[model samples]
Target: MSTSVALAAALAGFALGFSMIVAIGAQNTFVLRQGIRREHVLAVVAICALSDVVLISLSIAGTGFVLGALPWLMTVVRVAGALFLGGYGVLAARRALRREADALSVSGAEPDAASRRRSLLAAIGTCLAVTWLNPHVYLDIAIVGSLANSHGDARWLFGAGIAAASVLWFTTLGFGARMLAPVFARPLAWRILDALIAVLMLTLAVLVLLPLFTGSGS
Candidate 1:
């Protein structure tokens, strides 16, 4: 690709990746939790970025049409994702309410290191499932990738550029947030983060469910 096209592709990819992921959701929440605990950050980031790569690749390779052909599949995904989001939102809100005095200590938790390690791995697995199992990820990747391909760019190059953006953004988010672990060590800060997470999850659940009710009315 020419320098100008490559630059454009890279910028486009970065913008799309950032925009899609910057929202607060289960995946980002899990990543932030891992960051705070200072464990398995890279592994969690890898799962997220790699999942995006695979989904975006499938989207660019004409799988977008196949997904489009299965409207019921999308409906199934929408319902399942909504339920998951809502359930997670309730848990977050419950955490917000419990609001223990010592909830945010980074170094004081007494679990054995092995147990902590397993918890980190479990968190990573959950993040991967939340990102990969959601149907909207496929819709965004496939639609965006196919649109980029229509611009006559090399297909593999386009997908690679987009995938690179995913890798870069999630890695930064996972690691960069960990850099703030000191600040989050404060119980008050942890409370604020948990409250914020609760609101974000509930807001997203509302966004998901509003369409269903509205569409039914129309």
Candidate 2:
């Protein structure tokens, strides 16, 4: 009976985590961009998945109480996230409008060693910022942690399931994106993708700040 309960809790956690994360959001958008570009895909995916693990663990450990005690923290994160998303959206829009012929290639361009190193570092920094600065991540962590705790002894199992989901989803998104390289080989396809990503990011930025302006809890 105990083992069955644990399994059930684990499944529930995975379902909830996957559902929440599968939605189109700023973090996921960034990951998809990196994947499509084939730019440090492994590092980007690792940062995203590991960041989820740390946030969920902290939430389960009751660190979320800190945010509750300090309401201003959420506000800071909200504003910063909105700014970041808005900036990225503008950049994407510019890319979409550029006249230069740019398209994906399976054999992608190879930069010099120093250039590759610098680009890798930049990608890592952006990945960390994107993962950490999102207000939605904290909200999701809070929900997941609270639900996990409801399972009593099965809480750890539940968290493990969530961790598994994070790893699986990010892995699939990062690596599976390569399959689309053929379609993105067309410059028009690249433009369309960048345009869509720009709209998504800008919309998410407004959504992140909506609660603040309306004085409603998200």
Best by lDDT: 2
Estimate the TM-score of every prediction.
0.84, 0.95
- Runs of candidate 2 exceeding 4 Å displacement: 106-109
lDDT of 2 by residue, 1-218 (tens): 38899899889879877988887877787788788879899999999899988888898888677777787888999999999889889998999999996887656577899999999998988888778888888777667778888989888888888888999999999888888888888999989989998999899899999999999844
Where does the lowest 10-residue lDDT sum fall in candidate 1? 99-108
Supply every candidate's count of residue pairs whose N, Cα or C atoms clash at under 3 angstroms: 0, 0
Clashing pairs in 2: none
In candidate 1, stretches whose alpha carbon ends up further than 4 angstroms from where it belongs are: 1-11, 102-110, 216-218
Supply the global lDDT for candidate 2: 0.86
Instruction: Give the clashing pairs for model 1.
Output: none
lDDT of 2 at 81: 90
